[model samples]
Target: MSGADFIDARAQGRHDWARTLGTVALTVAGVAVVLVPTRLLVLPWLQANGADMPEPLRSGLLALMAGLIFTGAMAGLFLGVRLLHGRSVRSLVTTAPRLRWGQTLLGFGLSGLLVGGLGWLLDPGAVKPLAEVDPRILGFSAMAMLVGFSIQAPAEEVVFRGYLLQVARRVFRSGAAAVVLSVALFTLAHLGYGLESALFSLTSAIGLTVCVLLLGGLEFAMGAHVANNLVVAFLFQDLSDANAPSAAGVDWTELAANIVVMGVLVATAAVLARRRVSP
Candidate 1:
């Protein structure tokens, strides 16, 4: 069989071509729609005109704007596919999510340890202050952060791995191509982070992209992304400055550790997937 034929065979029952195409179209439309109202109109308007706006108001507005953008993108993909491509809304909602919850949680725990543990190692002082927070406040923060990150991270996975990667796999006929595209876009989405941050994000995306492709699911990647961000937003207090091993840059030791941990987790997931496929 030809390469396209091979890929088509593999993805045959998994996704509908028309639906994937519709999702791509809507995702692009969502980007165009959100830019004007959210980015141009609200952000600058608030900063320039709302000098009296409290810090909380400013932060809340920004978060709302970001959430809107995220929601728009997801709606475009999910709704666009259903409306334009005539796909089932239920299937669209759950596409590309062959979740192995156990493996996914393992991946999350492993990556968290690597990332968080390294920060502790490189600067032993890093872990000290984390324990100083009030238990009640920390508990609230952890719950809030996890809920927020869960929304954002899964939407990201659906857009990139579930939608973009599937279409790319159809066109390129290689999982690697889909992975590369996904990783590049993933990094680009965080470009506001500057050079170092972007570099670190790119490295992180590669590791994640590989996990998604090899395991043929977004669950593990979603778990790892959420866990990593949660640690930064909740558990950790002080962060290193921009230059010396900041959040953006993945340390060599930790990066290696993530590879091992994520590798094992994905490998186990792949084995489970194979068993599921077997007669």
Candidate 2:
């Protein structure tokens, strides 16, 4: 059950292209509909009312709100795979002969270690000293963010690599094409963050897609993404500056470094995935 086999199996079946495309439309629309309650409505409410609360508590509230919103999309990915493609939900998850949860968890640990370490080494400015966080609040805030990222990471992986990659392959007939198209689409999904974030996202999408393609599933991508988010949101919790948009601009140096880091992640995952399948 290689990715190729999964794609071919779906393509050979009696499924309508229009219906598959409809699934894509529905999923994206669902995200927008969901954001109305989770982000659009709630974010302003938080800004107005949450300011009086402890900063850590405010942050934790936002994180929990985001997690619930993203989890909805993750569930949609499952339904989309089954109802639209007439394929098992598991097939879109992994093309490996069997699901490998151990390897997936390993991917999470490896990515968290490597990305967190490398980000600190390359840009000393990327992280603040842990001493800055109040010991009382840090533990709770971190837990809240961890829950948020856990749901957010798999949402992106499942939609971009798991669902759309399969569609891209059927339509384009090339893995490279699927990867490129999916990366571009994923970048567009970040349009609200402005150009820099949109472009920066492309690097990550490419890296994760490469990992998914090589590892025969989205597990490595999901793990890597979740860990990456934690590193940025936690370790990089700062004395100054933030990933939160203050202005719109692209930093080429930062973007290039991101690409290099992502490439390393994909290469590492490939090696690990290989070891797991070896006789």
Q: Name the candidate that leads on TM-score.
A: 2
Instruction: Put down candidate 1 lDDT per residue, 1-279, tens digits, no spaces.
Output: 122322233443344566666667788788669866766777788668556643223333443455567676777876775676555433322334344576568767866776677666666654534365566645554555566566676678777666666567767877678768878998898665446557666767776666665555666777787777656544443221212435645456655554555565556556655765678
- Best candidate (score: lDDT): 2
Model 1 residue pairs with clashes: none
Per-model C-alpha RMSD? 5.9, 3.4
- How does candidate 2 score on lDDT? 0.71
Task: List the candidates' TM-scores in order.
Answer: 0.67, 0.82
lDDT of each: 0.59, 0.71
On the 0 to 100 scale, the lDDT of residue 12 in model 2 is 39
Query: How many clashes show up per model?
Result: 0, 0
Model 2: per-residue Cα lDDT at residue 259 = 81
Name model 1 segments beyond 4 Å from true.
1-22, 28-68, 87-99, 127-136, 193-195, 237-279
In terms of lDDT, the poorest run of 10 residues in model 1 is 1-10
Candidate 2 per-residue lDDT, tens place, 67-139, comes to: 7877666666556667766677777778766777876677778778877777777788757566666777878
